[model samples]
Target chain A: MMHHHLILRVVTKMLVGTIILFAFYVQFHGDFSPGGGFQAGVIMAVAFILYGIVFGLNKAEEVFPPWLVHKLAAFGVLVYAGTGVVSLLLGYNFLDYNAFNPGHPSHGQHWGIFAVELGVGITVTGVMVAIYYAFAGRPPPINDEDW
Target chain B: MVETIINIILFTMLVLTALAIVRIDSLFAAVMLSGVFSLLSALLFVTLDAVDVAFTEAAVGAGISTVLMLMTIALTSRTQKKATRSGMVPFVVVAVTGGALFYGTLDMPNLGDPNAPAQLHVAPEYLAGSIKDIDVPNVVTSVLASYRGYDTLGETAVVFTAGIGVLLLLSGLGRRRRKDEEGDA
Candidate 1:
């Protein structure tokens, strides 16, 4: 097999950085731009996958530890679900924006929406990263003699 | 006119990339092509003005899924050295099923029609009332989180399921053995 080149390494790093920044841009600018939580998560996942392909699976795993990714993914869902539960506890229906804040319905809604979107972003990004590590880390098959 | 042209180009690229995914013998190349398919689909979503769906597709389809696939490929097989021969019956069945699905889609609304029934329904209410109803600038977010929060919750659950599935699928006896060794040391 051909060894990975330095240029490929630099390009991969650049691409990864670019993807992350773009994800953030997409996440925050969802109100105006053509992106939101899903786009950002996918972008980050792609970046990591690129990193794995160009650098090495071990290095990619090192950068994004699997345990941490699992936690983040779980946390993302918690955040989203928690938002609804919070609204429900506040005396409104599940995910009722009016209940987010007692008096300021619109403000509460805004905050709630932002929080949920952030949750979506977190969960998706983590799950994707975890998947990448799992797949890329598969051991090469053993030979018949080794078996 | 320019937007329409760009959409056409993106659609073409998406088709080409998808075809490449099938044709490429190398598993890695196939995975990469799949990512390109996701990227192009994201572009198509943007063109169709379904930003929220586009965002989700970008993250799940292109980002996390691609990496996971690569990891799976690594664990299972690196290269497609041997071209396995398959019977034609299965291929014919799959082709016929796919063709029927394709034909079914023909009756759907034209892509990105602002005045379609879909646009006229709950979407219009969200677009118009979001400012007054939820007071959010982005109707998409408002609809997703506030009006239709159940759907968003379900989506999150799906993400959680996927994470759990990955952990379960990839973890095995050797992995546990390593953990045990580390713990003992």
Candidate 2:
């Protein structure tokens, strides 16, 4: 039953890489484009979730273990909060980007935005994947034929 | 002219999809129709020149949420149970709430109105200052990450809290598996 759909498995294999690449593009190119951390993060999570759906949950879990997913989720929040704390330590207002590069405030803003967006991306990806795992891990009460 | 046509088509599709979802007895069909609804709304967002929102709606709404709903259906029943009670009271409540909401929209500014309160506020400064201060071409990103960093931070925290809550609730499965193994040993 697991390997029943050859087309789905093969197609997912081809699509996964492209999805991840697009997610990265959306993440880094966000400053110049319509996407940002949130959209990018969702796209990234979709890749993993797609993999899980096609290849079965066990294989996907092997790729990204639950423990790691939980850690990554918390770590993203820490990274975001840490950036603000750093600015505070530097005697600037909370989340003041000017503190990152004092001579060129715009450069500092760029760096600060990049870092915080990265944090947002990471957290969102982790949270989404974790939630998917939570839902998919439970055994369905009904059989496949019922649907 | 083209934009108006596109908007009308998309909105019509959205209304039809919503009606189909309401009329459908099959849970799976409803889920699929909701995904269609999301895709239509994403197209609407694109026509409105909010590509980021469109991208998010397409990905999260059409993609992830559909998958989540399907998973939920797997866990539960595929067909919705027939309502034993009449839906009149609920219908009246919905109509009243929707009417009030529609009434509220009368006070809202027309689309793309320059004199709108939203456009008259700090948005102009953000648009003007973003390139000079943040040096980002995407003013939305600059505004979200720099100008309103705290608000985004709060949003992130909210996502974090929700994830943790779901994990706490559903994480019992792993413990149960471990206990089963111990019992076997």
What are the per-model numbers of colliding residue pairs? 15, 0
lDDT of 1 by residue, B58-163 (tens): 6667766676666566557656766467758888998999999999999888877788888888887788888886776777767777788789889889977977
lDDT of 2 by residue, A1-147 (tens): 357779999999999999999999999999999888889889999999999988989999999898888888888888888999999999899999999999999999988998999999999999999999999888879775565
Name the TM-score of candidate 2.
Answer: 0.96
Q: What TM-score would every model get versus the actual structure?
A: 0.78, 0.96
Fnat of model 2, as a fraction: 0.87
The digit string of per-residue lDDT tens for model 1 on A1-147 reads 115477887777777888789888987777665566767776766777787777777777788877788799999999988888888888888877678676877888778877888898899888877766665555656332321
lDDT of each: 0.77, 0.92
What's the alpha carbon RMSD for model 2?
1.7
Mark the regions of model 2 whose C-alpha exceeds 4 Å error after superposition.
B173-185
The residue-level lDDT of candidate 2 at B52 comes to 85
Off by over 4 Å in 1: A1-5, A8-22, A44-65, A140-147, B1-16, B51-64, B78-87, B112-116, B173-185
